[model samples]
Target: MMSDRLFVYGTLMRGYDHPMARLLSSNAEFLGTASIPGRLYLMRHYPALVPSEDPDEHVHGEVFRLHRVDEVLAQLDDYEGCGPSDQRSEYRREISQVTLDGGTELDAFVYYFNWDVARLPRIVSGRFQPEAFSG
Candidate 1:
């Protein structure tokens, strides 16, 4: 079954002033903070998440219940550069298991990096620090 939940760990997370973040807040219901087993890497102004098998690795983020799944995902897909029109997308959206703050595990759609990250610095803390990009 398809899940209407989405997990955002980068600029789409709450408290971000990005237009896409605002759009997400207006179009979906914020469930709560959640985490998934993954490694985070700095991709210039944003962060990218790569699935990890190491239990110690985790990427913290927030989960949202989509009010209009198709519409919202369409916009998010385009913004993430993985929409159908994007021939060489840098990310791919997929359903992954996430653990909420209360320990509830559920499937949620997540955008993961689709390119090589060998040279990128890893966000060891698992949290994306937006301030690091602020000039």
Candidate 2:
């Protein structure tokens, strides 16, 4: 069985408040923190990741080696509102190069935002820190 890998940067990252975090942790090997070149955004409730060409911008996240990719992704696809037939979904799954904390790089699946972020606020820290909504 081939093990698939995924990199989650937002709610899916361990220690977040999202319930999906537990599901992912139980089904995959927690490979520790990793980062990739991108810009993070606050898109209402959750954060969105947009590709960045800037070398200085590295989006922080976690890496997981999945033993049951097909099953895991199917569940994640629903949570992320992504699928093979959903072109209108807010996020789209794509393969990206992620660098581990120690500098090891690996190709992993990532969910990229599909909508326009022109007016969205950029998360300057590159880390998605979840907080309670003041509203």
Candidate 3:
């Protein structure tokens, strides 16, 4: 299939303004609020979602439909130390069902970090407000 639009909800969020937005070039479409149905924790200044069975806990993040998938994916792969051959690395791009606050569902690529939670430094929980992929 052709490269599809993607959604990011963590570090890519605004305020944090990580470095992923530059490659995107144009502004992304803010679909709405989204949740991954898991517990999000801060790991070494970064936020990560830990899949949980609990229904009360949810990973809150915004939804952005990213364009220019081809170029964006390339830069993302490089930053995550992943390529065609390597799947297991610092982060893995995954298609997860992220739901918006209003219950809108969509297909998006979430970069789930591959680092061990215990090994990585843990930051204060509920620190980063995941509302935008760009500042």
Q: Evaluate all candidate structures by whole-model CA lDDT and list the values in order.
A: 0.93, 0.89, 0.61
User: Which residue pairs overlap in candidate 2's backbone?
Assistant: none
Better of 2 and 3 by TM-score: 2
> What are the runs in model 1 whose C-alpha is more than 4 Å off?
84-87
TM-score order of candidates, best first? 1, 2, 3
List where candidate 3 sits over 4 angstroms from the true fold.
Answer: 1-3, 25-27, 119-135
Query: Candidate 1: worst 10 consecutive residues by lDDT?
Result: 80-89
Candidate 3 per-residue lDDT over residues 1-135, each given as its tens digit: 432646555656655545765444354666776777555556544576655577666667666766666676888778655556575576677777777778777777766766567654332342355442224
Could you say which candidate leads in TM-score?
1
Instruction: Supply every candidate's count of residue pairs whose N, Cα or C atoms clash at under 3 angstroms.
Output: 0, 0, 3
Better lDDT candidate (2, 3)? 2
- Cα-based lDDT at residue 87, candidate 1: 43
- TM-score per prediction, in order, is 0.95, 0.92, 0.72
Arranged by lDDT with the best first, the candidates are 1, 2, 3
What TM-score would candidate 1 get against the native? 0.95
lDDT computed for candidate 2:
0.89
Q: Which numbered prediction scores highest in lDDT against the true structure?
A: 1
